[model samples]
Target chain A: GESVGLHLPTLSVQEGDNSIINCAYSNSASDYFIWYKQESGKGPQFIIDIRSNMDKRQGQRVTVLLNKTVKHLSLQIAATQPGDSAVYFCAENTGSWGKLQFGAGTQVVVTP
Target chain B: EPEVTQTPSHQVTQMGQEVILRCVPISNHLYFYWYRQILGQKVEFLVSFYNNEISEKSEIFDDQFSVERPDGSNFTLKIRSTKLEDSAMYFCASTRTGVNYGYTFGSGTRLTVV
Candidate 1:
């Protein structure tokens, strides 16, 4: 079975520092990867995504990096803020229509 | 901006009772999906629907679970006989297009089976 997993379960960083979260996926055939932020009692919200064809994609304050060679994916947040503290999950779609397989998730904490 | 909406933010039911989770996806979205997350666990895909029919479904969506698009706006997931293990947060999501667009997820409905 294919699975997506995170290297770390929790991450802590300063308010103004940069944070990077790493994920590893077992299925090399996965063509699409997405990062989601979930609050305490809410559903996951899309943060950023990158296709297999591209190595990296950048958004307003977030960036997603994909390394197909090692089947690794990472999400980088610039200038972490208190509002950014949440559980982050990485998901992979294996050519299924909107069907996503999500990782265990990493909890991001920003220290004031 | 359009967004997905789910009903009954929280539900409480006894074991063996039936439960129905309702969701209304974005008006124009063509794809609909259902996912569930056990407390502290990862989100798992349950099913996907399009064109008034099921396009894909996971093993978890077995005989006890079913989905339907009763009307143009409502998509629902019904569990015939809920068990204690069925307690989890169910999320409904929709995408404007397949593969290219990001999915918009609803707030989620928490089902607690006692």
Candidate 2:
């Protein structure tokens, strides 16, 4: 699970289109970044991850991008589907053992 | 593909009663953690357990809250006296390694105070 804010930013995309979610991390020393997708009442499901040493990593149809200078991260989903709707969060591991700081999540909606 | 397991998917208790939330992390994992999410708020870290002791905890994990590894396979979070505000979804997570690797989170136990 990840920390959330008072409100979650929502993104709505067409079924066949692509969806891009963004997050700005606070710690400069964070070395590992993970993205999680959470459905309504369940726990977060790991989507993809990228380490500080790499700028980009790709999975089945998802890609993660990291910008060290700006401490920004983004998750890109290609050909979105109905099941793609969920809250997406970006978490950073501070290189301090196992503590993770999570960003406010983005609620994504996919429409057919 | 091992997963974390939590007991009592939903719990309802009196405001002043003591409630214990249980979790069974992946058998081979070395690190365990507890997290909670209020109705409309973000997920928050509560505590992290390792080697039969607490490794880290947040401010929210105050005097009334405690965690234990009473058995080899069970980890529990105990609230000495519950409050209405304590109603939330508590999640348990674990990782095989310390970091760099990802974690597996339990489905969660929804606690409700009556």
Candidate 3:
């Protein structure tokens, strides 16, 4: 079956440095993608999103880059902070009803 | 900011017992959804509800699972008979109709079947 997947399971980064998380999705028909942050024991919080028509989108301190040609998605966090330490998931919206298919997730750790 | 609310942060039930997970989506939101994540697994979509009916459902949402919007505010998911594999964290989410919007998710309900 087609699915979404992460390139890395964990990422360790120094505080104040930029962090990049990568994801790969198998379905080319997927039109919308979202990046979510989940703290321990909490639901996923929306960070940013991009449509297939656009290649990149930016938020407060985050940026989402979509590469449809390669079926790749990446989330870049600038000046990573301790609060940024969490499991980040990349999800693709599928079907007319817009049900999201989520990747396994990449755990980001920010160290001082 | 408005938020989605879920009840009973954690629940423990014996196999074969029924369980109902409750949620209250943002008041003005038009679409509601249910998703679940097992330990060490990805979040999986179970069902999406809109216009007081199910707009889409995954294969995981079998006959044993049901969803209801009993009133204007509360949406619920019921499992007729749970199995050990049913243990997971259930999250409720809501979103307004749009292609550019993101869904707001509740904290979640952790169900443990023994």
Cand. 3 Cα-lDDT:
0.92
Model 3, B7-109: lDDT tens per residue? 9899999999999999999998889999999887899999999999999999999999999999999999999999999999999999888435658999999
Among the numbered candidates, top lDDT falls to 3
- TM-score for all predictions? 0.96, 0.95, 0.96
- Please give, as one word, the docking class of candidate 3: medium
lDDT of 3 at A107: 93
**lDDT scores in order:** 0.92, 0.90, 0.92
Instruction: Give one digit per residue, the lDDT tens place, for model 1 in B1-114.
Output: 788999999999999999999999999898999999988888999999989899999989999999999999999999999999999999999988985685899999999999
| DockQ, model 2, C-alpha based | 0.58
- Native-to-model Cα distance after best TM-score fit, residue A46 in candidate 2, in Å: 0.4
Kindly give the stretch of ten consecutive residues in candidate 3 chain A with the minimal lDDT sum: A1-10
Deviation from native of the Cα of residue A76 in model 2, angstroms: 0.2
For candidate 1, give the lDDT.
Answer: 0.92
